[model samples]
Target: MGQQQDDEDREFDIKWADGAEHKEPSARARMLAARWKENPPGPVPFRGEPEGVGPRWSSWVSTAVVLGSVVAVIVLLGYVNFRAPY
Candidate 1:
């Protein structure tokens, strides 16, 4: 029984050596390559805003807030400079 088990284990053992000959791609690989050749994949579709969907109102509100802050800073600076006693 032990000798039989040893033989079975030896059957599965793979022997590796340098300069091994290269093998052709398997059947599944060849089939996939042919399919790809027939209908080559294109660039991944752009996942931009969905159709019929417009920009969110929050985006507009944020833009307005940023612009308003910039204008307010400019106006405050002008007022302060004009009031400075030179």
Candidate 2:
């Protein structure tokens, strides 16, 4: 069992690269590739304000209003159901 575990953990020596000659890219390919020379693709810079930076009192007030409305509707529904004659 120990020998099997050792074999499983051992990395196999695999030859991935084929002996192929490197070819030069075409003129159009080089022209398209030149765009990245100025601005290389990478993580975007943090320009704007951090998340939730400003005062969030308005958001909290709106959330409380919505929740209170929902609770009031639920209570009204329960009261109506309780008063219904079967």
Q: Which candidate is the best by lDDT?
A: 1
RMSD of each: 7.6, 12.9
Q: What TM-score quantifies how close candidate 2 is to the native fold?
A: 0.35
RMSD of 2: 12.9
lDDT at position 21, candidate 2: 58
Measured on C-alpha atoms, candidate 2 has an lDDT of 0.76
Once model 1 is optimally superposed onto the true structure by TM-score, how far is the C-alpha of residue 41 displaced, in angstroms?
27
lDDT tens per residue, model 1, 1-86 = 99999887776553322234775788999998999999988777678678899877798899999999999999999999999999
Alpha-carbon lDDT of model 1: 0.83
Instruction: Provide the TM-score for each candidate, comma-separated.
Output: 0.36, 0.35
